[model samples]
Target: MSNRIYEAYVVHENDQGKYKGNIEKKRVDDLPKHGVLIRVFYSSLNYKDALSATGHKGITNSYPHIPGIDAAGVIEHSDDRRFKEGQNVIVTSFGLGENTPGGYGQYIRVPGDWLVPMPEGLTPFESMVIGTAGFTAALGVYKLRQNDVFPEDGPILVTGATGGVGSLAVAILGRLGYNITAATGKLQKKDYLMMLGARDVIHRDKVKGQSSKPLLQSRWAGVVDTVGGSILDTAIRQTKPNGAVTCCGNILGAELNTNIYPFILRGVSLIGLDSGRCLMPLRKRIWRLLANEWKPTMLEQIAQEVSLSELDGEIKKILRGDQAGRIVVNLNINAQS
Candidate 1:
């Protein structure tokens, strides 16, 4: 591979069983045998990357690992005919950061099918800024669109609105002219949410249903729920008839204390969005949407760039629920600045 010598953030399992991350030199040959070798120009942090970095066994089982779910760059080598060297591409999910060596490294060797050619309206940096978080957010918004939810239908509620997925969802929905009610735990960032196209910004607590009733006041023609658990449950119950809800996160908690009334009575559709497992055709479609008409208007406001050496602190911040927007890692940038 041409992008041979590089560096990566390696997570080590200490003798005491604690995990620590450090920057280390790495080689392209070290990556798993795959069809394409990419020199990643940029990668963006996601909640899953945080988990994998900290050695969450549920997200990653092995050690000496590099965790980054989103990568955008140029191909350095290709065993597959579909992709040629120097071709720009984007790869996210589909085990890139989980079971396989991922974009945290300056280079990634991945399967051919796990790739999507970089869309027309985006550069590598811009694509990483959109990353998996924005892609998933776009997927959720797409589901809302596919289900016939229109801006004129009613306001769309985005739970965890200050987060990566939530904020981007708000931006995309706002770009589409949807009236958005963003529910965030950090209300101090109300202005931030509003700037991202949210017409209304509410506290995350507002979505936590206070009663045991099967349903509540009908609102939200559709919902983009980033946090599962009670917030999602509350949202489903409160959705208007024939409304659709797309769920893409479980940071709040995975257990759902919900029933079927929201489904049978209101015809509320609960669409589970798993970006990693989505078929290629749909994955490419979503990326296209992100690069085109559905692209967020305030893209810069939704993302911040950081060097790889600064990643550890950001990982800690995200795990603490202190992150406000997407964190892009500029692979071309050096640690010493």
Candidate 2:
């Protein structure tokens, strides 16, 4: 436990101000001083991880980072009595892949409180398949339900339906018998969305743009928006009276220029989901839901595996909004877990 060598995908900044990541040898002693060290078996990609890997200052100001916000694996060591060696656990967000070394490596050292005991029904791979994206999607949907949004309320709209969060949202809502209208820029994925149980798939063009009027025709009973900016505003104004909207990303843009009509007049509620730093209690609740009743029947369909060495091109694809589902990272593909 005191001395071990591992490999990780590390991002470095050159003098020219460009960032590049590659697989390199690393040592256990190089990790941050923390209570628990995990032998990571699986991780998953998210937009923020891509940003961090590409040297986005807002996401990661430091260089030579390992960018993976979600990790599921066994514990290698622990100073904390709550966790023991060989126990499977999960670590998501909490400054991971940002200011701290993240799960793109074969191991990660983090505070024990940041981990959730692997739920009874989920394997490490399955949990990473759900990852942060699926967790956020589940949290958003749970929030909607908590706010009284139900299947019979009317059709729910999911923006960026092909992406990780959006895709998982569709699957969970579908399992709950919601009429889901999935919107995406990649119209070619219509069949994929349909298979995920979306009742309808619409071009992202239909969900974009802003109207001068305070409100447009009401079309959605509620919304799970993965991309922000104009699409959020459009969905807000078009939401039915008392409808709720959950926002989890800003891939489209961060600035949301909208009016008070949706909130004051229409009684719409805009709920912001910050999965990265959400309370530990809420994190456990969401993970339980994801491992049980709210788990997607299409869970396996939403992920494709990639080794750390294969992450460069995948990072570029996600940055370009070309990703359609979760991207799992198998830390030791050639070695047994």
Give the runs in model 1 whose Cα sits over 4 Å from its true position: 1-3, 335-337
lDDT of 1 by residue, 167-202 (tens): 899899999999999998899999999899999998
Measured against the true structure, the TM-scores of the candidates, in listed sequence, are: 0.97, 0.97
lDDT of 1 at 262: 90
Model 2 root mean square deviation, Cα atoms: 1.4
Per-residue C-alpha lDDT of model 2 across residues 122-213, encoded as one tens digit per residue: 88999998998898999899889998999999999999999999999999899899999999988899999999989999998898995668
Q: Model 2: number of clashes?
A: 0
* Model 1 quality (TM-score): 0.97
Cα lDDT computed for each candidate against the true fold: 0.89, 0.90
Question: Every model's Cα RMSD, please?
Answer: 1.6, 1.4
